[model samples]
Target: MSAWLFDLGNTRLKCAPLREDGAPGEAVALPHRREDAAAALAQVLPARFEVAYLASVADPALRLAVLEALGARCRRIAIARTQARFGALRVAYAQPRRLGVDRFLALLAAHARGGAALVCGVGTALTVDLLDGDGLHRGGRIAPSPATMREALHARAPQLPDTGGAYREFAADTDDALASGCEGAALALIERSRAAATELLGRAPPLLLHGGGAAALAAHLPDAIEIPGLVLDGLARWAAVERAAGG
Candidate 1:
């Protein structure tokens, strides 16, 4: 039986299927809306799946809509904050129930890959999660995304113009100025979090950069390891554990 994984994030929804052997198949992304999710699923999934897992960080209404759409076609499994032991990584959330399931799953997935890792997800917001070599989820941080900074500035201040240029290390003029500033701010925040994680872990954890804003910040993060589909990877791992537990 195949396993279907859904990552319901703030800005977008992503879905992918993992074959029985753990190989990822096709993946798709849609806007984070009930109508869009329903339409996308209708277009892509015609047959019933074996197991379905969801990691949502969006509105509860939209999340329910997704669950309703999936219906009785598959065994639906919503990821929750549970005591998960993957290697040596101990989930230490103050209130596991309050923690983002997607973040937790992503950290678990990175731990499954072995060794210390800094799992960074750059989407509507940027998140940096630290996992030690012993597989302990020490902690993480969240900050505004590069695009959000630029957009927010444009929205709040009438004087700031929207400059459609790639983020660079140095801005030649005003247009590039906004781009560089916003991008630099995001980079600095991420780097600071990385440094903190390094200090805690005693070595620079292998960085795993993922999400929409990853490409924009790629130039800024020279030494970090970049990996796409981290959420999908995490969902897949979570599905395996859920299956073993007969959920």
Candidate 2:
């Protein structure tokens, strides 16, 4: 039976074929805006799928619209949710539901690699999560991502451009300064989180970066591992575990 994975975020929706080996195939992304979603998905989805596994952090209306579209082409749909525990991985959130499933799934993917890690998601928002070698969640932080920062600044000041320019310690122009300030703020938080995680774990954990805007920061963090399909990867793991247990 053929299956697929769908990761729906605030800005876009990413879908991929689920291979027999239980990994996501080549991914295709589409903006989740109400007007564009249906047409975009239609162009990418296969004629039919035996199953569809989804993890969504988009608003209810958007999710429902996507679900409606998927239901027409998929035999069964499995939604990914944040849980207190998934095998050995324990969630740090007092209320698991409150933790975005994307972040939780990212932790699951990191834990499955069998090591301590500082997982960072750079998308609509910058999210940092810490996981120990033993698969224990160590909490995390969230802040407006550099892109969001730029957009917000531009919204308030019409003269400020929302995009472009380069990052520098001290920029000579407004565009460069805006870029440096926003990107630098995000980089600073990641560095701080990494330092704290190191102190708490007594060893520096490897950094894992994912999401749409990760490239912006990845250039600066030489050691950071980039996993473009992180959320889908985690969803794949969840799907495998569930299937094995006959869920």
Q: Compose the digit string of candidate 2's lDDT tens values, residues 1-247.
A: 8988999999889999999899899998888786666777899998787888999999999998888888988899999999999999999989999999999999989998889999999999999999999999999999999999999999999899999999999999999999999999999999999999999999999999999999989999999999988998999999999889886
Which candidate wins on TM-score? Answer: 2
Error of 2 at 114 (Å): 0.9
RMSD of each: 2.1, 0.8
The global Cα lDDT (0 to 1) of model 2 is: 0.93
Worst 10 residues of 2 by lDDT: 31-40
Model 2 misplaced regions, further than 4 Å: none
TM-score of 1: 0.90
lDDT scores of the candidates, listed in order: 0.77, 0.93
lDDT of 1 by residue, 41-146 (tens): 7766757876678888889888888887877567665565545555465876866656677778778778878898988888888888888877788878888887
Candidate 2 contains a number of clashing pairs equal to: 0
In model 1, where do residues sit more than 4 Å from their true spots? Answer: 72-77, 80-87, 158-163
